[model samples]
Target: MSKTKSPIELYTKEYYAACTLGGIVACGPTHSSVTPLDLIKCRLQVDPTLYRSNTSGIIQILKKEGLGKLFTGVGATCIGYSLQGAGKYGGYELFKRLYSTHLVKDEATAYKYRTSIYLLSSATAEFFADIMLCPFEAIKVKQQTTMPPWCNNVIEGWKKMYAKEGLNGFYKGITPLWCRQIPYTMCKFTSFERIVEAIYARLPTKKSEMSALQQISVSFVGGYMAGILCAIVSHPADVMVSKINNERKVNESMNVALKRIYSRIGFVGLWNGLPVRILMIGTLTSFQWLIYDSFKAYVGLPTSG
Candidate 1:
């Protein structure tokens, strides 16, 4: 009789698929749920004078655009981040193993240089993930930041953009999206790994010996810390992404658009939404890791470090 293979076996095709599924589950709903906060943040980034504060922004949006408007890009957020998450988490696992196995070859060497592996793996993963995210992101930002909104929904936005500028309209934000997401993901994955490792090192119980709830708690803590770092690292590019998508003139090249926007917003403008992003990303990331690891554990896989 043939022996049964473990479903949770590391680095296998099944394992990568599980990670991708977990990522989709982790990112899509969580990000969509936070669309109100994101909408406010994008508006703040684009026009700093729009609202007195985050709280006021919420009230203003409610008074002006109605409650449902807070979820302006919920569909795009769900779809785009779901696709990005699949590429990110699945690609990270693949690249991390590939790098450790091929580049270092020795287990000890791989462990010694694990941080670099984590950074490189995440950067590479996010590069492609942003490509998946960019078009939806462009739609989301345009609709959120525009005063009257660019379109009623994701489908309308997509049809209008395609009709207007063909593929280029959807893709014009790709460069800035890459700039925002790659560094953000690198900080997210690397810091989460390091924080989880540190937490395990200090704990009386070994990571493997910890209960499922305990392991997930660790994942949340690590994820929150990683998220704060991610916000700070990626805030500038994020602002630029919103600006470029919202204000780019017809026939203006990305380089020219960026330069003109920068000349106007200057250095202070780039950091406009940092605090809200820290809060948003921290909560969002913590839940993401919690959900992701919970899913992995449910499937009999070990929680990520």
Candidate 2:
């Protein structure tokens, strides 16, 4: 019988590439599958009174726009988030290693500031991820928020946006996208790492002794906890992202657009979709980490905390 070769060595280009592939698989379909929830969440964020609740939002969309409406932005969501996941997971892994090996260099000191390392790595990863994600996110938001729905689909939306506003059109919301995602990612990685570490500490079994299934389960729990914090921390900026994409005026600067949206909505409006988002993000984050770590284990790599 032939034994499988050991998993790719950590911190190698191959390792990062595998993680990026894993991220694409983890994020794309999962985010696409949640299109209906995202549709409702975006609508609710844009206009808090759009529907009484998530249930009614679905019912109303079906009643008024048909079943297909629930998946208005699935294509954009899939492609955009896949790209984002690649950058986020892969970059986090790469930067974490670089920061530890090059910056800290000392194992004890690195361990001492591990949380900071997690935060910085995640933030740096997300900075680039959001740039790749911005155009698609703009397209997705416009599709969901428009009364008639923006365009037939992502392709049409892209063509139309390009025709109307050129390349800059797609990037109008980059600033808010960064504001929303950077902090969200920072919270996500940091909290998940810390929480998983804590869970392992509390358990009698060390992490290395745990089966793959058990380790991923810990990832799920930690991810869910981290997600709740992520949603709350980032919701306000998320609201602004949707608003900027849907409501920004021609030639309006990001700052001006932000001020305008805030004036219309007020501070309370920023939290409009809080409850639904917490549910969405908590579930989403758990599954993302679950899938990510599961993929890692399948490839013979160690599961992340």
Highest lDDT scorer: 1
**Overall lDDT per candidate, in order of appearance:** 0.92, 0.91
State the displacement of the C-alpha of residue 96, model 1, in Å, after optimal TM-score superposition: 0.6
lDDT of 2 by residue, 1-305 (tens): 11345469877888999999999888888889889999999999988889999899999999999999899999999999999999999999999998888888699999999999999999999999888898999999999998898898889999999999999999999988999999999999999999999999999988877788889999999999999999999999998999999999989998898888898889999998999899899989999999998998888888897
For candidate 1, write residues 221-291 as lDDT tens digits. Answer: 99999999999999999999999899898789989999999999999989998989999999999999999
Q: How close is candidate 1 to the true structure, as a TM-score?
A: 0.97
lDDT of 1: 0.92
TM-score of each: 0.97, 0.97
* Clash pairs detected, candidate 1: none
What are the RMSDs of all candidates, in order? 2.7, 2.0
Question: Which parts of model 1 have CA positions greater than 4 angstroms off?
Answer: 1-6
